[model samples]
Target: MLAVNYTTLRENMKTYMDKITDDYETVIVTRKDNKNVVMLSEEAYNNIMENIHVLGNKSNYDWLMESKAQLENGMASAHELSEAETDE
Candidate 1:
């Protein structure tokens, strides 16, 4: 994560954008008067949206938590995905 003032960001927009895209770093751009905004790579944004989609649903949240508990309790084991799925 990185924080940069809006002025600095404007002055070095390309550098900041490069860092965000290549390094997958989240940036907080602070404006005057305490206003702020965030910048993230498309991949990061999609991943976050996907997680929100799953965790935002009640049944999905419950199932995920239950599976996590089972794994922690030694009731579940991890397995490799099939080649076809991994190709994605």
Candidate 2:
């Protein structure tokens, strides 16, 4: 995460934006009167939203937890993909 004041961010907008997109970094643009806003790449934002949607569902979350526990307990098996499946 990076933080810069509003005026500073405005002065170097391109550089900051490039850093955010290229490095997948988040920035906080601070303003007067505690009006702060965050900046992030669209890809990052979409990934976050996707995670929220997946984790927010009770059934999905439970299934994920169960899978994790199974893996931790060595109750999972590994299978090799066939040539056709790998091609897909």
Residues 1-88, model 1: lDDT tens digits: 9999999999999999999999999999998888899999999999999999999999999999999999899997678887655554
Candidate 1 residue spans exceeding 4 A from truth: 78-88
What TM-score, computed on C-alpha atoms, does each candidate reach?
0.83, 0.90
Task: Please identify model 2 stretches exceeding 4 Å from their true place.
Answer: 85-88
Which pairs, if any, clash in model 2?
Answer: none
Q: Model 1: how far is 57 from its true place, Å? A: 0.8
- Please list all clashing residue pairs in model 1, or write none if there are none: none
CA shift of 41, model 1, Å: 0.9
Candidate 2, residues 1-88: lDDT per residue as tens digits?
A: 9999999999999999999999998999999999999999999999999999999999999999999999999999989987654554
Query: Each model's RMSD to truth, in Å?
Result: 4.3, 2.6
* TM-score of candidate 1 versus the correct structure, residues matched by position: 0.83
C-alpha lDDT of all candidate models, in order: 0.94, 0.97
